[model samples]
Target chain A: MSALALFQVVSLFLMAVGFYGIAFRRSFVGMLICVELLLNGAGLGIVAAGQLTEANPVLAQLSTLLVMGLAAAEACLVLAIIIVVAKRWKSVDPSVVSELKG
Target chain B: MQTSALVLFVIHALIIGVGGIMAVASRSLVRALVGLIMTLFGVSGMYLLLNAPFIALMQLLIYVGAVVILIFFAIMLTKAPAGGEEERPNQVRTYLLALMAGVLPTFVIGWVVLTDQPASINAPLETGLKALGQGLMEPYFLAFELISVVLLVAMSAAVILAFKRRQSR
Candidate 1:
């Protein structure tokens, strides 16, 4: 297999790892970390596709940039939510957070 | 395909794989954060291998520098910085679930990746950078500006949410 394909596989694995983390992680922040992992896997996939394929490489780089920007915004908001949740619920575990259960 | 490049790629792959495993498998929040940093650095190295120095630098600066620091502070603020993170019930079942959830997609996607045809686009090296500049300056300009607005809104909303939560004490 080509190196590109291998890299793509690695990215796919990262996404899976992230998905698993999301599925099982008890804490909200752990889930958030998993989300970041998912995003990074996607960004890496885009970058790798651009590098390997003859398609518009700029598209990949630009998308990765956008992903990075979005990730920053997401981290900011999620951290704030974690702080609020921690204060209100006195626990960061998502399993314990059930105020939205309707 | 040089030997040196192959060696570097091997090093990077090990870093990414091990770090990712540790990030998810470890129970400690601090250890997980450390693993995440290691994974991101490996990712940045991959970006360098992909020939996008600018993106690599951005990954290092934004993810490694800003984002991780923010997470660390959040951990401290949330009272879970050092350890004592809660593990969910049915540890064996969760492990089984995680394995199933992770492995299935990897298998499916790996098959497709192995069978897919190669890409056929042929753009010059410098042109990619040029196109990015044009995109930012023209077609993508509005989106770029909107991103700033989104950041502003998110910042304000986060502050408000935290303030409201604080006030109800």
Candidate 2:
């Protein structure tokens, strides 16, 4: 396999692991960590594709920067939500805050 | 690929793999946060290997410096137990389902990647800080401005959401 393929495999591994974490984690913060991993995998994949394929490297890097910005924004919002949940519900467990479950 | 680069790639990938597993499997949220930091560091290293030193530095500054610290503060504020989360009963089926759901995409994409090669490999470009700045200020100016707006909105919303209020109960 080429070096690029190896990088792609690593990205895939990260994505899969992140998805599993998101699905398995019971707490909001844990899920948030997994989401960050997923985004990293996505960024890695984009950069790998741009570097290895016939795409514009500048655009790829730019897009990854945007993804990073989005991740930061998401982390900000989610952390705030987490704090609110902790204060009001007195726990970070998702199961404990299941009022919307039907 | 050169031997040195290959070795470095292996090291970075190992860091990411181990860190990601720890982040997911650890019971303690604090330990998991540490794992997340390790993974972020490894990802920045990969960015360096991909010829984007600026992005690598940014990843370190933004993720490790800013995001991780924010998470740490949140953890301290929430006061989650240091002993870690307790396991719920009867979760085998759920675990299996989640595993399958997660692995499916990797298998599908890996298969395609193995079977079909990319048409051509592009030479790496030296995207200096100047070029990146010009690109952001020119062709991608709209996206740049929008991202700033989005971040501002997010910051305001976070403050509003986390603000304390007098509750008459």
What is the lDDT of every predicted structure here? 0.82, 0.86
Name the best candidate (by lDDT): 2
Q: What's each prediction's TM-score?
A: 0.91, 0.93
CA deviation > 4 Å runs, candidate 2 = B84-90, B120-123, B164-169
- lDDT tens per residue, model 1, B122-152: 2224335677798788777887898888888
Model 2: CAPRI class: medium
DockQ of each model vs. true complex? 0.61, 0.69
lDDT (10s digit) by residue, model 2, range B8-35: 9999999999999999888888888899
Residue pairs of candidate 1 with colliding backbone atoms: A54-B121
* Candidate 2 i-RMS: 1.7
Q: Which ranges in model 1 have alpha carbons more than 4 Å from their true place? A: B87-90, B119-131, B165-169
- lDDT for A78 in candidate 2 is 94
**Interface alpha-carbon RMSD, every candidate:** 2.4, 1.7
